[model samples]
Target: MDIVFEELDYCETHMGDLMLRKRSIPSLDGKIIYEVKLGEEFLMSSLFHDAEVALSHLGLDSFGTKQVDVVVGGLGLGYTAQAALEFPNLRSLTVIEGLSEVIGWHKRGLVPLGEKLTQDSRCRLLHGDFFELAQSANLDPEHAGRKFHAILLDIDHTPEHFLHLSHGGFYQPEGLEKMARHLHPGGVFALWSDDKPDEGFCKVLESVFASVEAHLVEFDNPILGGTSSNSVYVAYAQ
Candidate 1:
């Protein structure tokens, strides 16, 4: 098969240069892949999204089968948001994406899950800084002070390794407390991390939430010829 690569879109933002691209790798059976990059860092790829899907399942599963209002911190290929809608009990999903370019990829059908997310009435892709919105009393712009049953975040690589220095505060106790206010009682907050589980961060979550658990999500890494893992942290409000 002929090798194919294309840069779908590119734009500059306050954080850095944001880009969306699609390509097919001959070595990997020429499977088409969608990728997002921020400056030097590769934000997400369609090729490996097991953990993203796991973030939704592990988070919402805590609520049992009750209808849930969910807020996803990052849109990244729409995997997390799309997975959230898979739950029959999910009443609504609000995805907060900091870069409009990322959201445009989905709106323009540049990514695989784009149309699925756009066509679904339950999902709303809102352009805003998640950290900033998380501090607010509401995640949905249309509904002021509206609380949610779950908030699944996949923004930074990890709580310790932030995409931006400003994001560091959100991992702190004060920041977590502010975000917790937006969740309904017994609601859950879940996060995806590229790094291994951090005991210190779990302690911080334990401080604000009634219960906390960190799950290790492992998946096949075809490119690397082995399994890679990500961590998901779930915390329940009192």
Candidate 2:
């Protein structure tokens, strides 16, 4: 039997109430959609992930090296990490997620891309805070002071909006420089934002990176009966 609506999992964390749900909309031909919510805000949905996938392509495609080691901040729905693994030349992918419940969804096969990521020898799911890790030099605990070829971030809503107050520092010039230290020279840093391209954030990127570009990715909005767009900021470290 098809579940019209089901809340798969719900738990309380330091962050807030986190819930994972699966539902089918009869109006949309019973298309099953998986949704994750933290507190009152909807974190991610399986229905709209075009920008999430683009975060990987835009970042990895801009890298100068063929063998790329990548770090993905935020494991929401595993879309960004899964997309990064699709790269043929990707050497390794480390995903840093703040919440353990989110990781549990993947390890327990509650999410669609769970097994695909876990079975892949190249991917590693690490439980930690991305913002805190960004401040530190090493993203991987196994390797101290290791630099990556690319860092793809999808944690906060935008450079100005954040899930936590502490995350706000990562967008600043000093914090950005700290995160840049963990990337190889000419490495890529791409971010996914729900808002349209922001010129202010671009200026911040230009201050730290050799080049910067904001890509507007548009996708169909089935529920809204129109189109919606998201912003992707891709920058290369000098």
Candidate 3:
């Protein structure tokens, strides 16, 4: 089967070059979303349903029956946002994407998978620096004290192997501390990583959160299968 590329968007990041391609075929129900090759490999796509499930699980567990506010760091294919919206208790979902072009792709409906999510009244897509947003959330009195019930981050493959070196701080002790501060006491923080990080990263998480655990997510499809597993790190603020 051949994949037809319908649209292409390019972005030059401090780390390297990145592109998003919208591909489709008659047999598929909707357009397939692909993040163009980064370094030498393609990161992820709409085809991976398990990764999205991992994100949804976190929100469902945290929200319970109360209206929960969520802050999702990356808006990849709107999977996390879509999952957040599924929960009736979700009061608001703020999806912050670092790249402006990525936001455009969603707004233009290039990635049909995320079209409904982008249009949801509860979903707010912000085009800005995620790290900055995270930091600002910690400083603003109105936001700082308001702990988001759940924070889902899918920004990088791993905390250590940041897509951009400047983002390295996010994985460090200070960064985790800042993140913990933003969470309402007992709130949960969930992160998605393409690969597992070193023990040091786990230790950093443990230092801030009362408890920390990693869950491995596996997919069944052959094209989406292999040893390529996504790890979800969950931590609860003390």
Each model's RMSD to truth, in Å? 1.0, 1.2, 3.2
Could you tally the backbone clashes for each prediction? 0, 0, 1
How much does candidate 2 score in TM-score? 0.97
Local error of candidate 3 at residue 70 (angstroms): 0.4
- Candidate 2 residue spans exceeding 4 A from truth: 1-3
**What's the CA error at residue 196 for candidate 3, in Å?**
3.7
Instruction: Give per-residue CA lDDT, model 3, range 1-111, as digits (tens).
Output: 566785476767654676777676445554554655555656667667577668668645855787788888888778878877888888988888887767887888867
- List the candidates' TM-scores in order: 0.97, 0.97, 0.85
Candidate 1: RMSD to truth: 1.0
What does the lDDT read for residue 171 in candidate 3?
78
Q: Residue-wise lDDT of candidate 2 within 1-238, one digit each (tens)?
A: 4648899999999989999999997878899999999999999999999999999999898554589899999998999999999988999999999998888999999999999998999999999998888897677878998999999999999899899998998999999999999998889899999999999999999999999999999999999989999999999887
TM-score: model 3 vs. ground truth: 0.85
Among these predictions, the greatest lDDT belongs to 2
Extract clashing residue pairs from model 2.
none
Clashing pairs in 1: none
Which segments of candidate 3 are over 4 A away from where they belong? Answer: 1-3, 11-15, 24-33, 38-41, 137-146, 224-227
Model 1: per-residue lDDT, tens digit, 47-164?
8899999999999986776889999999989889989999989999999999887888889988888899999999888999999888877667678989999999999999988999
